[model samples]
Target: MTHRTQLNQAEEHLRRSRENLPVAAQLLYAVADLLVDAQPAEPVTNRVAGLAFTYAGLAVLAQYPQAVQDAALDRALAVVPEARPSETGGEWALRLRAAAGSVR
Candidate 1:
């Protein structure tokens, strides 16, 4: 599948995970692992990176272990800071910043 397709699937899993579904975290993690393992050929768009970061931040907010949250945020930052809101990022960027703030 294309990177976009994978990203979309990941986004869906993340949403379900946010709703406190027991199995959703596993699905989200699987998608995250797949994305990490299958590094994209071309750089992903800022929006896509921003979404990933937001998801990671959400996981942190949901009280996943500190190590897992840190790893997710670290990976997200490595790809794109996504630390603040921007024209390109909108709410996702804001959500990321909020998540980061809560972690501290």
Candidate 2:
């Protein structure tokens, strides 16, 4: 099953404000929770900033740990196109579900 959690706080934040970090932070938190629910074996953390471009989808930013840097970059750089959903609530969750599936 594809599970997508809508960060309404983030969406609300985006709508009322142009703050990126707060929104991105919520995005990151949602992603982390999604990953755990999706696959418990794999652990992902946002130790550094992350980047998700329209074409690139989602990519890890910031410095990576010594052992995982290259691999993380490789995985992050390979993401397909992605964007913030205009649809509120469940729509955003589905988008995240799709993105997670794409990652797999």
Candidate 3:
């Protein structure tokens, strides 16, 4: 499936999982929509930042404590996209995993 399709599916999953939490459900859907509709011509840094924010948003949907979610946010933001231009998506994902783990 296309990446956009995958994102839409993910959004649906998040919505289904958090349907009871109205505010979180809304936030999750909004984030997914933004990711799926992101401009291809946008700068790499912006895309990287979007991924970072999505990671933090997912942490919240996963029912992490506020402290852990904040830590994830901080760690994700600390990744300077411009400085890591050579890193692949998998590498950044690993970093995000480490960031979340570090707080636990």
TM-score for all models, in order of appearance: 0.28, 0.27, 0.34
Clashes of 3: 0
Q: In model 2, which runs have C-alpha deviations exceeding 4 angstroms?
A: 1-64, 67-70
Best by TM-score: 3
Which stretches of candidate 3 lie above 4 Å from their native place? 1-44, 51-83
What lDDT tens digits, residue by residue, belong to model 3 across residues 15-84? 6765454333334333334433453234335565577457637645356677755654454345323325
Point out the worst 10-residue segment of candidate 3 by lDDT. 95-104
lDDT by residue for model 1 over 1-104, one digit each (tens)? Answer: 99999999998876675555322333234334333544433344555664653664564435667666556555534433332333333433344333433322
Enumerate residue pairs that collide in model 3.
none
Which ranges in model 1 have alpha carbons more than 4 Å from their true place?
1-14, 17-61, 81-104
Q: Quote the lDDT for 100 in model 3.
A: 32
Question: Between the candidate structures 1 and 3, which one is better when assessed by TM-score?
Answer: 3
Residue 56 lDDT in model 1?
A: 47
Q: Write the per-residue lDDT of candidate 2 for residues 1-104, one digit (tens) a residue.
A: 22333566666765454223322333333553444344434322232113222212233333335445444345433542243333333333345445544442
